[model samples]
Target: MLENTQISILGCGWLGFPLAKHFIAEKSTVKGSTTSADKVADLKNAGIQPYVFTLGANNNADVYRNFVAESDVLIINFPPKRVEHIETLYPAQIQEIASHIRFRQKVIFISSTSVYQNTNDWVTEDLVNQPEKASGKAILAAENILREKLQNRLTILRFAGLFGYDRAPGRFLANKKELSSANAPINMIHQDDCIRLISAVIRKNVWGEIINGCADVHPIRKRFYILAAKKLGLQPPEFKEETTVSFKKISNLKSKMLLQSTYKYPNPLVFVL
Candidate 1:
């Protein structure tokens, strides 16, 4: 394990802040980025050296080059919000990053399980990514760019729906609003588990691999949220349709076998309830 390695995190928002703190706790020098100038002081206060960066239709190449050149390991955690012409903007941002990434520096790209299409079958790292949605296709393209350019130095972490801390699952469905797809399978991972998985990758020097960073547990959507609301003494959200909905069940086997990681929140219900 590299006890004193330097790690740079681009896009220090919800997931990025926690990730930066985790690395700092492990004695790594962390450089976290945010588009907002105001967040720099906050990041510095949290023990991360902060950089102001924004990725969109107009990206400053010089800023990206300097950021990538200064670190040993780079974590790309930013996602462009859905907007007009996002399809074009997403790949352009990725290309800018790829062009600037220093040679030999390790990279971990935080992708999403949304890359998997709505298929009933289980999806693993081995399955071909045939994204049905435009966002998923954009992410897949970004992943491909990193993989092709970085070769053996890059690791891709495809996380499921994220919920933990300020993003409590129960709160999302506590009101008497109607819920869609009641029987849809839920695949989620807590913020703590995300940190642990990233730590494991850094510690074990796991590279050139794509791992699913999600909990093993799969529960029906309605049951999961209803139980969460009940636990919190709130009225359960009403279900609109109780029909079966298909999703590619994510597997964390690769993460376990490669990094030898044991999940901090293996069961999503534990935190949901």
Candidate 2:
């Protein structure tokens, strides 16, 4: 049971905030950190032990140290910023956080499916990742950094395109032009699924594993987005009519075999805004 498990989430943003609420409801002791001081009260009101902390900067040494030291499990949920020198800077940022983490402390690092390059086919956990995007490369590097630091004590979860809740797909490409890969598959997951999957990880005590969190079905990009747009009554984005398009279908077989749970929202095309 997650009851009484001391959990600390590094970044209490979209995904982390809901996760905190879930853990709290399950009777787990949740201590969450937010970069924004304005949001501190919000976290506190919701019964989370809040810390207004930032990595690689001026802050209280004792507070930060205690925040990490008191947790049974530390969740690294912050996403790397989209900026220049991310290849080096991102890992360095993670290294700073990793430093505060005890050598034997269990950790869960939230990763992205962007680590895997678009091979125009089904991609699995063991596939060699050769990401072309800067963000993807940075996330992969951070994963490697944490692996070297925490090895078997770490559990890395790579998630596909995040949607559902306040993050609707209709706003992504609404009324946009010149969108390519109309036939490309959309490998996405819902926030509800993400929270359940993470809870399963902590509950099952699954560590030293790289699990992929994604939906069961892959929907064509054009059809999925258009349907999503119509749901929100937004202008459907235009896409090129490509007979053949490159795509990468993220395989969730490992997550299924491990978690043994079904996705609440399996089809992205039916993803209600």
Best of the candidates, TM-score: 2
> For residues 137-205, what per-residue lDDT tens digits would candidate 1 score against the true structure?
889988998989999999999999899888878877887666777888788999988988888888888
Candidate 2 overall lDDT versus native: 0.89
Most accurate candidate by lDDT: 2
Task: List the candidates' TM-scores in order.
Answer: 0.93, 0.96
lDDT agreement with native, every candidate: 0.85, 0.89
Which stretch of 10 consecutive residues in model 2 shows the poorest summed lDDT? Answer: 264-273
